[model samples]
Target: MVFRVDMITLMFGLKRYHHLLILLGFIIATVMATEAMIIAAFPGIEEEFGVSSVIIAWILPAVMLVGAVLLLAIGSLGDILGKRRIVLACLIVYGAGVALAGYAPDMPTLLISRTLQGLGLAIAPLAYALVAEETPVEWVATSIGVLAATYGAGSFIGIMSGAFIIEQIGWRACFLVMVPVVLLLIVFAWHIIPDHGIRKKGKIDLIGMMLFAISILSGMIAITWIGLAGISDPLVWICIGVSICSLFLFLRHENQTEDPLLDLGMIHEAPFPEITINAFLVVFSFFILLQVMPYLIASPAGLALSVIYVGILLMPGSLTDMISGPLAGFMVSRKGVVIPFILGALFLLFGCGIYFLFPMTPVLVVCIWMIFSAGMSILLTIDNMIVVASAPPGSTATASAFLHTIQSIGGALGPIVAGAALTLYAPEEAFTVIFLVVLGVSAIILFQSAGIRRHLP
Candidate 1:
C-alpha cells in the first residue's frame, strides 16, 4: 500500500511540471523549424530573386551570423534583466521578421527580415536556462534532453513540411505559416513562464559587446567573401585584417572590463573550454554534411534529386535525431555525460566514415545520413547538458550563449567552406574533401572525449 502510494506521488510530481517542458519544446521546435525550413527552398528563392549563387548562399549564414554575434550580449542581458522579459521581446521581433519575410518583395528585403529573425536565437539558451533553474537537479539532464529531441523534431518538420509547402504553395507561404505559430508560442510563453526569475545585478558592457560583435561579424564575412570572391580579392583581405584587429580589441576589452559581457574568469573554468571547443568541432562536422549533402543530391553528377525528394531522403536523419535526443538525456541521467559524449563521438565518426566508403545512391545515402543524424542528435543533447552543468549557478544562460556563439561560428562557416570547395573542385573531389575534413574533426572530437572522460567526476 505504501509503495503504491509513493509511486502515485512520484508520477504526479513529474506531471506537475510537464507544462513547462511542453512550452520549452514548443519554443525549441519553432526556432529550429523556422531556421531549417528555408534550407530546402534556397534554390527556389534564388530562382525567384535572380540572385547569384554566392548571394543565395549568404542568406542562411547571414541569419546565423547575426544570431552568433548577438547571442552572448543578449544572454548577458537576460542575466542582468529577466529572461522572461527578453523572451517576450525576442518573440515580438521574430513574429515581425516572419511576417516581413513572407511579404518580402526582393532579396534585400528578405535579408533584412532574416536579420530580424536572428534576434530570436537567444531564446534557446534563455529557455534552457529557465528550465535548468526551475527543474530539480535529478531531472535536469532529462529535461534538457527532451528539449533537444524537440529540436530534432522541429528540424524534421521544417525540412519535410517546408519542402512540401514550398512545393505546393510557394516559399512565401512557408514563412507566412510560421507567423501564427510564433504568435501562439508568444501567447503561451507569456502566460505559462514565470514573469520574474533570477536576475544578476550588473550594468551592460557596451564596449565589450561592440568589439565582440565586430570581431565575429568581420571574421565570418571575411570567410564568406573568400569563398565567394577568392582570397586574392582586396575586400577579402581587408575584412580579414579588420577581423583580426577587432578580435584583439575584444579580447583586451574583456580582460580589462569591470563588468564583461562574457566573464573571462568563468570561461577559464575547467571543462567549459573543453565543452565549448567540442561544440565548435561537432557543429562544424555536422553542418558540412547538412549543407553539402543537399548540393550533392541535387547536383547532376550525383543523384540529382528534386528539392522535395531531397527533403524526403533527408527526413530519416531528423527522425533519428528526434528519437535519439531524449535517449541521450536518459543516458546522461544514469551514466553521466562522459559515456554519452564518447558514444556520440564514435557515432559521428562512424557516420562520416559511412559516406566515405559507400556508393552515393538515394537509399544508401539515406541510411548513412540517418546514422549521422543520430550521432548528432546525441552529441547535441549531451553538449547542452555539459554546458549547463559547467555554468555557475544563475549564469546558465550566459554559458549556454557562449557555447552557442562558438557553435554558431561553426554553423556559419560550414556552408561557406563547403560552397567554396564545390566551387573550386569537381563534385566528387569536393565531397571527398568535405568528408575528409569532417572525419578529421571527428577524430579530434574523439580525442577530446577521452580527455573529458579522464576529468569526469
Candidate 2:
C-alpha cells in the first residue's frame, strides 16, 4: 500500500516527463536497432555480393568507427548548435543514408552509405543529455533505465525481424522498410523535444576534433586490420604506431586546449574513468558474444544452425534485457546504483564462467547468453545513470559522448578480435579462449564496481 502511494506520487510529481523519456528512448532505439539490423543481414549480404568474409566484416566496423570518431565532435556541436537541431539533421542524414544503402549497387557504395548513416550515432548521447537536463533528480536514473530498456527492445525487434524480412523480401528491403519509420520518428521528435534549452558559448575545438578523429580512426583500423591480417603485416604495425602517436598527441592537445572536445578535467574525475573503462570492457565482452554467436551456431563445425535459428537463439538475450532494463531502473531508484551495478558484474562473471566450463552447444550457448544479456541490461542502465549523474552540470552531453566514443571503439574491436581468435585457433578452442578472456575481464569489472559505490548518489 505504501509502495503504491509512493509510486503514484512519483508518477504525478513529474509533469509530462514520461512523454519526453519515451520519445528520446524511441530515437535512441531506432539508431541502435539499425546496427543490429545490419548485423542480422550480414550473411545474406555476403551471399549476394559474393564477398569474402573478411570484406563483409568491414561493413559494420566501418559504421562503428566513423560514428566513434565523430561522436564527441557532434556532441560538442549539439552544445553549440542546439541538441534538437543537430538531432533532427542527423535523422535526415540517417534516413537518407539508409535509403541509399538499400539501393547500393556495389560493396563500396553500401559501405559509404553505412558510414553516412553513422553520422546519427550522436543521437544517443544527445538524447541522454536531454533527458538528464529535463528530468527531476529523483527520476533521472529511472528515466535513463527506461531509455536503455527501449534500446534493448529496439535491438531485439530489429535483429529478429531483420532475419525474417531478409528471408521474405531480401536484405536490401530491410533497410528500405525502416525509412518510413524513421521519418515518423523525425516528425514526432520535432514536436516533443524542446528546440531551445542549453547552449555553450565557444567555437568548436576543430584542432582537437581533427586530432581525436585521426587517433580513433587509426586505432580502430589497426585493431581491425590486425584481426583480418596477421600481426606480421607491416601495415598493421605502421597503423599501430600511428595510432599510438596520434593518441598521445591528441591527449596532450586536449590537455592544453581551452575548449577541448572531451573536457579532460571531467574525465579525470572519480567514477568517470571507472565508468568509461568499464563501459569499454563490458561492450568489448558483449560484442565478442554478439559477433561470434551467429558464426558459432551457423558454422558447420559447430551447430550448423540456419540464419533464422541463429536469430532465434539470440532473441532471448534481447528480450531478457528488455525486461531487465526497467527492473534495473526500479532497483536503482529504490536501492541506489551500487547493488544493481554489482549484481550486473556478477551476472556477467557467472555467464562467461559457464561458457568457459561447458562445451559449445546451441542450447547451452543460448541459456548462458540469456544470463549475459540480463547482466548487460543492468550494466547498461546503471552505467548511463552513473555517467549522467557524475558528469559536471552542463556537460552531460559531452560526458555521455565521451563514454559512447569509448563504447563505439570497443564495438569496432569486438568482431575483429573475435574474428582473429577464430582464425588463430580451431572454432571450439577459439570460443573457449574468447570466453575465458571475457571471464577475466568481467572479474576486473566486478572489482571496479566496488570502487564506484562511494561515488554514487
Candidate 3:
C-alpha cells in the first residue's frame, strides 16, 4: 500500500509538469518563430529601408547585444520577484517590440524595436529554472530535452515557413502576424505557469547590472565595428577599452555587493567554467554556417544552388536537431553527463570531418550539417541541465541566465572568428580553415569530458 501510494503521488506530480513542459515549449517556439522570421526577412528589410547591407547588418547583432545586456538583470530579477512575473513581462515587451517593428516608420525605430524583442531571450533562463524548481530531479533532463526539441522544431518551422511568410505576406507581415501569437502566449503563461519563488526582500543590483550591460554591449560593439571599420579602427579600440574597464568594475562591484547580479564565486568554481566554456565553444564552432553557408551555396565560390534547393537541403537538419535535443537529455538522465556530452562533441567533429573527407555537393553538405546540428542540440541541452543542476539556492534563474550570457558572449565571438578566416583566406580555404578551427574547439570539449565527469550526477 505504501509503495503503491508513493508511485501514485509521483505519477500525479509528473503529469502536471508534462503540461508545464508543453507550455514552456510553446513559449520558446513562439520566441524562436519570431526570431527566425527576422533573419529570413533581413534582405527585404534592408531593401525596404534603402540602407546598405553593412548598415542593416547591425540588426542581428543589435538583438544579441540587447539579450546579453538584459539577461543578467532579468535573471536576478526573476529570482527575487518571480519567474512567472519576469516571463510574462518579457512576453509583453517582446510582443510590443515586434508589433512596433511591423509599422516602424524609420530605420532607427525598427532597429530599436527589434532590439527590444531580445528581451524574449529572458524566457530561456526562466524556462530552465521553472522546470528545475517544479519538476522532479530525475525527470528534469527529459523535460529539458523536450524544451530543446521544441527549440529545434521551432527554429526549423520558423526558418522554413518564415521564408514563405516573408515572401508572400511581406516582411512587415512577418512581425505583424507574430503579435497575436505573443498575445496568446501571454494569456497561456499567466493562467498555466504556477508562480512560486518570490523573494520580495531581495535587493536589485542596479549598478552591477549597468556595468555588466555596458561591458557586454561595448565588447560586442567592438566586434561589430571591426567588421564595419576594419581592424585598425579607433571605434573598435575604444569599444574594446570600454568593455574591459566596465568588466573590471563589474567584477569588483559584484565581489563587494550583498545582492550581486551574478555570484562570481558560485560560477567561478570547477565544472561551471569548463561547461560554460564548452558551451561558448559549441556556439563559436557552429557559427561556421553564418560564415560559410551563404557564400558556399549562393556566392561565386559556391555550389550555386538555388534558394529553394538550399532550403530543402537544410530541412533534414531541423529534424536531427529536434531529435538530438531530447535524446541527449534522456542520455544524461540515464547515463550521466560525461558520455552524452562527449558523444555530442564527437558528433560535431564528425560533422566537420565529412566536409573535408567527401566531395562538396549540395546534398552532401546538407546531410553532413545535420550531424553538426544534432551535436549542437545535445551539447546545449546537457550544458543547460548542468546549469540547472548547479544553480545556487534560490537563484536558479540567475544561474541559468549567467550560463546563457556566457553562451551569448561566445555567440558574439562566433561571427568575428569565422569572418576572420574569410579575410585571411580564399573563400574555399577560409571555409576549410573555419571548420578546422571548429574541430579544434569540439576536440577541447571532448577532452574536458574526463575532468568534468566527477562533477556530474
Candidate 4:
C-alpha cells in the first residue's frame, strides 16, 4: 500500500506540468475562435449594419491594435499579479466581450464588444511564461514550442470551422460559440494552472498605460486610414502627428520610471533583441499572405478555391508548424540555438526562392509555401523559447509580451502593405515583390545568426 501510494504521487508529480499545457491549449483555442469568428462574422454584420467592406476591415485590426498596445503592460501586470490570476481576469474580460458581441444591437455596440475581445489576446504570452516557469527544464523547450504551435492549430480550426458555423447558424452565433469555450477554459485553468509567483509590488502605471495606448491606437489608426481612406485625409495626418509625439513621450516615460512597464534594457541584449526583431520581420513578411491570399483566392484572380480549399493549403503550414515547433524545442535542447535558427533562416530563404519561382501556380505554390511556413514555424517557436530563456527570472511574461507585441504589430501592418502593393501592381508582380523583400530579410537573419555564438545566455 505504501509503495503504491508513493508511486502514484511520483507519477502525478511528473504529470502536473501537463495541466498548464492543457489550459494553454484551451485558452489558445478560445482566443483563436474569437478572432476567426469576428472575421467570419464581419460579412454578416456588415450586411446587417449596412457598412462597406473597407469599413468592415476595421473590426479585426482595431482589436489587434488594442492587443499590441496593451500586451507588454498586461504581461508586466501578470508578473506583478500572478499568471493564473491575470489569466482568469482576462478570461472574464474575454467572455464578457463575446457575450456582448453576441447581443450587440448596433454597429457601435458590436465594435465595443470586439475591442473587449482583444483584451484576451494578451493571454497568449502569459501562457508562454507560465509554461516556461512551471515545466521542467528537460521538457521546457518542447512544451513551449508545442504551446506556440497551438496558436496555429487554433487558427486553422477556428477559421475553417467559423465560416461553416457562420453560414449554418448566423453571425451572432459566431460570438456565441466563444461563451462555451471560454467557460471551459476558465474552469480548466482554475483547476489546473499553478500559481507562478507574485507580481512585483507596485502601483499600476495608469499614466504610462494611457500614453502607450494613445500612441499605438493613433499609429494603427493612421496606418489603416492612410491605406483605406487615403493619405491625403486630414484625419490621417492628425493621427500621424499625435502618434509620433505620443510614442516619444511613452518611450521617455518608460526610461524614467523605476518599475517601468517594460525594461527596454532587454532590447540591448544580443540575440534576444535581434531574434525579436527577426520575429517582427517574419510576421511582417509572412503573415501578409495570411490576409492577402484568402482575399485573392476568393476574388477573380485566384484559383477561386473555396474556404475548404484554402483551409487545405493552410493545413500543411500548420502541420509543418506543429511538427517543427517540437522539433525546434528538441534541437534547442540538444544542440544550442544557432544551428536551429540558422537552418530555419536557410529554409525561409529557400521558401522565398520557391515563391519567387512559382507565384501564379496555386497548387505548386502551396507546397512551396509549406516549406516557407515550416521554416517560419521553426524560427518562431525557437525564438519564443529564446525570449523566455533570456528574460530575468520574474520578467518572462513581460519579455514574451514585448516580443509578441512586435509580432502583432507586424501582423497588423502586413495586410495593408500587401493589399496596397496588390492594388497598384499585378498579383504576380506583387507576389514577386513580397517574396523579394522577405528574401532580403531572411538573408539578414542568416547573417545575424552568425553572431549568435557571442550571446548564448
Q: To one decimal, what is the Cα RMSD in angstroms of model 4 from the true structure?
A: 3.9
Question: lDDT of each model, Cα atoms only?
Answer: 0.81, 0.79, 0.76, 0.73
Lowest-lDDT window of 10 residues in candidate 1? 1-10
Tens digits of lDDT, candidate 3, 1-457 = 0112235347666466666678889988887777666555544565678864445555655566677777878888888878888899999999999899889887899889978888887789989888887788778888889898987787777767766766677667878888888998898777767777544456788998899888987876776666556869999899999999999999999999998887888888766888888888887777646445545665557686544444456667778988999999888877888888888888888888888788888877786779988989999999998887877678788889988887767765675555555655677887788778877877887777656777653
TM-score of each: 0.93, 0.92, 0.89, 0.87
The per-prediction tally of clashing pairs is 0, 0, 0, 3
RMSD values, in order shown:
4.1, 4.6, 4.3, 3.9
Candidate 4 lDDT, 215-283, residue by residue in tens: 877876776676566779999999989988988998899889887776778877866778778788777
Candidate 3 local distance difference test against the native = 0.76
Clashing pairs in 1: none
Off by over 4 Å in 1: 1-16, 455-457
Query: Candidate 1 at 295: error in angstroms?
Result: 1.7
Which one wins by lDDT: 3 or 4? 3
Relative to the true structure, candidate 1 has a C-alpha RMSD (angstroms) of 4.1
Best by lDDT: 1
Please, what are the lDDT tens digits per residue for candidate 1 over residues 202-303?
Answer: 877888878877877787677767767788999888888898998888889888878888888888877778878888888877877777776777767778
lDDT of 1 at 340: 80
lDDT of 2 by residue, 1-457 (tens): 0111235446678455566787788877787777777666666676788875556666777777777888888888888888878888889998999899899988999989988888767688998898898788877777787888886788788888877777677778878988998999889777667766667876688887787777777766676666667778888889888888888888998888888888888888877887888889888888877777767777776788777776688788888888888899899889988888899999899988887577778778788888899998898778887888787766778888888888888877776677667766787788778788788889998998877777554
